[model samples]
Each structure stands twice: as C-alpha cells, then as structure tokens.
Target: ARPRVGYFYTGKTGSQLLTEKIKKLQVYQYQSMPVVVDESVSVYDAICTMFLEDVGTLFVVDKNSSLVGVLSRKDLLRASLGNSNLEAIPVNIIMTRMPNITFCHKDDLIIDVAEKIIEKQIDAVPVVKHTEHGYEVIGRLTKTNMTKVLVDIAKDEII
Candidate 1:
C-alpha cells in the first residue's frame, strides 16, 4: 500500500484527526520528562545518574528552570579529560552554551524540523515553546527517534 495521503484537520476533530501521516511524523518524538538537572548540582551526581540510564542526550536546565545548556556524552568526557577533580565542577561550565543550542518548536512540522536537524548536523533538537513566562522545553527531537520513524515509513512503503 502506498503511503496514505497526508491531510489537515478541521476546526477540531476526535481520534479521526490522528492520521497515518501524523503518527509517522510523531513516531520518533519523545515528549515526556526532559533529562534536566539543576545548575548547582555537582556534575558527578548528574553524570552518575545520566550514565546509569540508556538515554542518548541530556538536557540541562538551570535553577530558574530555563534552558541553561545541553550536555552530551562527549561534553562530559571532555570535561573529565580536562579536570582531575571534575566531580566538584558544575555541568554548566562544560556544557554547550545556550546560544549554540538548536531549538525546535513542538508545533512545527516534523518533516521541516528533521530537515533542520540534518542541515545543522546536530544530533538532537530541543523542543521548546514560549509562553507568557519563558521558554519551556516540552520534548527532545533526537536522531534515534528520527531513525525509528524513517524505518517505519520504509516498512510501510515496502508493504
């Protein structure tokens, strides 16, 4: 069967609104709890907790609950390599700066967002949205989820 035609909804529908296209687009989306940590927390505890789990990337939020920065395995490694007493150091010092961060809107088209990820050569895109308050991260757009969605699409195309 060919990939079902993608369509938009009306003022609002029920479950019918959830089409095959939407599911495919969201197949790789992870929007539950962000891997966030306090800026004041020791990198040692953060690293210990993060490593024990099997997540690919970890999002670092500050005391204000704003996106202070992002920390990757490579960043932690580099920090450890540079410091013999890395335990005392905070993740913020070694994390990628917010300006260098790439953000994705939850409402943005997934296809468009995925293209951005490819164009930027970034491993992940932080899903953020601004309310009257400030930027709140709702999810993480990661390469792993993208790959999974693409694979499912391919399977559908084959069948």
Candidate 2:
C-alpha cells in the first residue's frame, strides 16, 4: 500500500505564505503614479477629478508639482456637508497639509506602508523623494494596491 501523504509533508505552503511574501515586497515594486490636483482647484472640481481619476484620494500639488497636501473622499464629503459652498472653496481649505501628512519612500517595505495606512486611518500615502526644494511626490501607495498584491499572491501569479 502506498503511504498516505500528510498536509504538512506536501512541502507546499498555502496562499497565506505567499501573501506574507507580498507584504514584505518593497513599495517601489508596486507603487503607481499618483493622481494629483492643484491646490487651487475648487472642491467641486476636486470631486470631479476624483471621479474622473477613479481614485479615492488625490495628491495636492503646487505650481512646481511638489507634494503639498492630500485629499480624501471623506475630506470632500465633510466639506460638502458643511455650510461652505463646495464650488467656491479651493481644495487646500479641506486638504490635509504637508508636514503633517504621512508619506512613504520608494524603498519602504509594503507592510510598513500598510501599517501606516491602517494606523493613520488614511486610504493612501504619497511616495516621495527629497528634493532641494522639498519632498516631491513620485508615486502613491494605496489600500487597493496592497489588495491587488494579495489577490495576485493568492492566485500564485508573479507580481
């Protein structure tokens, strides 16, 4: 009779192991270009940009395209519900300004970035690089991006 094969002896770890590896992957491996909106844009226009970009967050940039602020769906919703007129208000009025924004570097581990997102209760983080002027937005790491990595890992697809 053939010997029975136990699950542990199969030598193949399940999807969980693959997911663990994905979480350890570097941010530069999967980070994508951020969808940005100028700080001068009206909140109404910012909302439109969010819809047009099909993204939950937007990186607010200055004339030099440097990272200035971050705008989230909740921010827009809260501002719109307030007495202020959305059409007349610029995004900076409602955006989370720099020096307080949580940012990630391209070399950061995905898991570290994920932890920050969860801890800060933010949907996304701008991946930046130090420039002579200041931190310049290079990419963005989002919950959706991490989800995709997990899904791909589960499928055993190379990412």
Candidate 3:
C-alpha cells in the first residue's frame, strides 16, 4: 500500500502465487498510457471523446510531472459553458486542486484499494510513485474493475 513498492497484476504475475499480486481484472488496464493533459490543454480537447476512451478522470500534471490536479466531466462542462474560448482556457483554472486528489501506488492490494475508493466515493484512482526527477503516473484503478473484484471475493466466500 505504501508508495514505491513494486507488484504484478494477477495473471501478469506469471507465477503460481497470490501474495504480493494486485489483480489486473480488479483494476484498469489500458492498451497504452492514455494521452494526459497537463495544466495547459484546451477544453475542446478535454471534451473530445477520443481523450475519454480509457480515462475516467483527466489528470492534470504540472510541468514537472507531479500530479497537480484532476478534471472530471462535470468540471469540464461547467467550464465549457462559462468560457467562449473553452479550447484556449488554461486547465489550471478549472481542475480540482491539489491536497484533495487521492492517488494509490501500483503495489497496493485490491481489497485495501477498494475500501479507499468506496469510502472516498471516487470513481477512479490514479496510480503514482516518486522518481529521481519527480512523481509520475503509472496506472489507474476504476470502479468498474473494483466491482468485479468484489463479486469474485463474494463468490469465493460462499463456496
């Protein structure tokens, strides 16, 4: 659960083991790292369906790659209606600010992560960690996948 701990996603573990493995089926697994918008991207792009394919939240990182904020769909709509040049307005103006964004490390267990997401009422959690240069995103966990994990666990308990 702590930051910087390394882990494999369930089947990705490629070994006969359960401990220390985070389930891939229990979290978001994208074909590639989705194109992330920094603090300066256009709102037009924000509304683009292409940008939303695998992203549940628009992560706003600073120039240094540290997560600075997040922009949810509602936030984007509110800004779009208020600004004529939605495409040109800086994202920093509308993004959910720091100190409120909750992130998880990739190594965290799925059950522990599930509780955090449910308690926080977050649809998605950003997976992040520190580097010599700065913190960077590595993955994402979504409510959809968490639901699957919950079902699987329930089935196991019954049987």
Candidate 4:
C-alpha cells in the first residue's frame, strides 16, 4: 500500500477559486454602519449629514425608524442648485422614495448587491431587515466595500 497524503487535484483554476470565494461572500461580511436621516429633515441638514458622515448615500427613515427613502449626493446637489431655501425643503421631497429604493439583506450575496449597484448606477445600497411596517436599515454596502473584497481576493486574504 502507498502512503496516504492530503494533497489532491480538483482541476480548478486560480480564477475559478477567486470567483467561488467572491460568490460566497455575504453582504454582512463587508457592510458598513448605515448613515440614516429622518425623512422630515431639511435638505440642508441631510447635506450636512452626508458630508459629516463622509457617505455618498443616506437612508431616510420615518418616525418609526423605518426606511422610507434614500438620499444621494446627486439629490442634494440638485436641490442646492438655484435653491435659496434648502432648509425649508424637506429631504423626503428630494429623496428617492419607497418602492423605488434598491436594498439588500445581510444574508444576501455581495455579488448580487454589486450587480444592483452597477445596473442602477448607484453608489451604494442599504442592508435592511424586514419589519412589520417596513424595512429597518442595518448597514450599507458600497463600491468601496466591493473594491475591498476584490483586493482581498487578489491578495488571497479571503478564505
């Protein structure tokens, strides 16, 4: 009898291994803490929050803390242009409202969220939990996170 060894050939390429690792990544693994703003907050306030938080997207929540909309840098920019009363304009008026916002779950595949971001031409998406009333924002998945995943995979850091 020959000595037994653990080594075996799977006939898979390096790129295939990378692809499999990426495919197995979940949103929660790379999601960041969500930056949220109340729907009633003024556009001015939302803009400030966006800048202060250093985030491109802000999840808009209602009184019950349920996600109701999304605010992006573009939205604030458009609202600021030729608008003297930014404070008077509520974010809800300028936000992408419910039934239109693209979101993901913590357990969802990161690759799926990346596809949504690309297809929608959006910078990020909220990772949420379904509630009786609506969705509750838990985290955020952004292009930066996706980039990190790629970098990690290239470095063979992801097991």
Candidate 5:
C-alpha cells in the first residue's frame, strides 16, 4: 500500500495565493534574537558585534534598554569609508534614529514585515513593543527569515 501524503498541490500556479497564505503567519513564528548594541558603543565595536552575532544589522538601544536606532552593514561601510575615527565614533552618530527606523511587532504579520523591509530597502526590522517608558526591542525579522519560509514551502513543509 502507498503511504498517505499530508499535503498535496495541483499544477496550478498560485504565487498570489501562496503569498496570501504566508501573510497570515505571525512574526514570532520565525523571528530571531535581535543583535542589540548600546547607542554609545563605538562603530568599531558595533562591527565586531555584528560579526560575532553573524547578523547584517544591529539594533541600537539606549540606557533604558529601549529601541533608539538601527545600524546596518551599509552604515558601517559608509562610516569606515570616511576619515573619521571608527573607535571613537558612536553608533548613534550614524544610525537611523527612531521614528524613522522601520520595525514590526511580535504579533505583526511576517509578510507585512517582509514588505516593509523591501519597501524601505533595509536588511532587517527590529521587532518592538511599546512599554511605559518606550519601545523595547524584542526580536528581529530579516530577509533570511523569509527565505527560510519560502524554502520550507517549496519543500511542502510550511508551518
């Protein structure tokens, strides 16, 4: 006797349909631990943190551990290209400040975060939540996260 398959798909092209299905998934389903660095940390230290964490972006936090800014690989590259002192320059000086930083929440739709990343041309988005003090960084959504989802879907193992 043949084994029963848990999922099946016809020869129909359903890109839009699949996208709609993916959009229904929450960010927490695939979010990674955010790579956080203090805003006062040197740009050089931030680079080291990124390398150690194996992430392309870093979330800048303030003394209260609230989300303050965002720093990307491009940001570091730009700073390094200039004649400024990397060791003395703080990440906050070059980071994209809050209110301008694009982010999502744990309960947010993953597809929406993906769209924001694409639309904003950013490598990742800090998953945040509003606290009594301010927004706190909870997790992170990156292109890799979406790619993993796509790969799983291709293998017919989407969650």
Candidate 6:
C-alpha cells in the first residue's frame, strides 16, 4: 500500500470542520472551578461569597459535600429584598433545590449544555459527578465559558 503522506482534502468545508469541532467539545474542556457554599450558609454570607468570587452562580453543598442546591445572583437578590436581615436566612431556604437544579456532567457535549442554559434562561450550570450518595460538584459551566470557546474557535486556537 502507498504511504499516506501530506494533507489530503476529504471535501469537508471549513464550517463543517468547525461544527464537528464544536460537537466534540465537552463540558470539561471549558468548565471553570465551581464556587460552592454550604447549604446552611446565610443569605448575606452567600451574597458576599458570590461577589468575592465574581461568579454568577454558587453551588450549595450538604454536610457530606454533595450538591444539594444552586444559588444564583437573582436568588440572593430576591432574598435580600423585603428582608432587613439577610443573615438570618439560610441559602437553602431560597436556593433552587435538588430535582430542580440543572446540571451537566464532564462528558456532556457543550452544545447540549448550551442549549439547556438557553432554554432554561440560566447563566450557568454546575458540572457534577454522580456519587453513590448524590451528585458532587466538580466544576462550573457558564455562558462566559461558551463565549470563550466561540472566540477561541474564531481564532483557530482550538484546532
């Protein structure tokens, strides 16, 4: 057999190649470190952590460090309103609890996650790993990460 050398055109267009690359992109490829808070954390404290961490979403964990809920900036904001003492309110009281929180796994396609984010009108989703007890928060996938991927693809940096 002749040695296959040099570049050979398979007749795929640049857009097709780009689409394929995007499809192959997984949650782990662009996920960021998750900012987590204990479910018992005060709303005031959770708000402070969110600001300090500069994250739009915060994962709420139980005593076992298993994901229990999710706290978004909106949730904190809502809790802050009509309440003079945010410190007295635990995040779990206002957090989107289990069975309601949207999450993705590391192996999930970024495109699917993006669609979920869009369809749910959320800014971010927690990247989790399922354990015997429950889901463990491992990373965070946000709109910002998706934007970065788009920019990188445009620059051909992902190729």
* 1-88: candidate 6 lDDT, tens digit per residue: 4223345666776567778988999999999999999988899999999999999999999998999999988888888987999989
Q: How accurate is candidate 3 locally (lDDT)?
A: 0.66
The TM-scores of all predictions, comma-separated, are 0.74, 0.83, 0.67, 0.92, 0.86, 0.92
lDDT per residue, candidate 4, 42-156, as tens digits? 9999999998999999999999899999998998999999699999999999999989999999999999999999999999999999888889999999999999998887787
The lDDT of model 2 is: 0.87
Instruction: Indicate the TM-score of model 3.
Output: 0.67
Candidate 2 per-residue lDDT, tens place, 43-155, comes to 99999999998999999999888889999999999998984678899999889997889999999999899989999999999999998778888999999998987777767
Error of 4 at 99 (Å): 0.6
Q: Candidate 1 has what TM-score? A: 0.74
Distance from true position, residue 151, model 4, in Å?
A: 1.2
| By lDDT: ranked, best first | 6, 4, 5, 2, 1, 3
TM match of model 2 to true structure: 0.83
Tell me how far the alpha carbon of residue 106 in candidate 2 is from the true structure, in angstroms, after superposition.
1.2
Q: Candidate 5, 119: how far from true, in Å?
A: 0.9
Q: Taking the tens digit of each residue's C-alpha lDDT, what string does model 5 give over 1-159?
A: 422343556543466556667778899989999989999999999999999989999999999999999999999999999946899999999999979999899999988888888898998999999998799999999999999988888886763
Residue 69, model 6: Cα distance from true site in angstroms: 0.6
Q: Cα RMSD to native, each candidate? A: 6.7, 4.9, 9.6, 3.6, 4.1, 3.3
Give the range of the ten consecutive residues with the poorest summed lDDT in model 1: 23-32
Instruction: List where candidate 1 sits over 4 angstroms from the true fold.
Output: 1-33, 157-159
Could you tell me which residue pairs clash in candidate 1? none
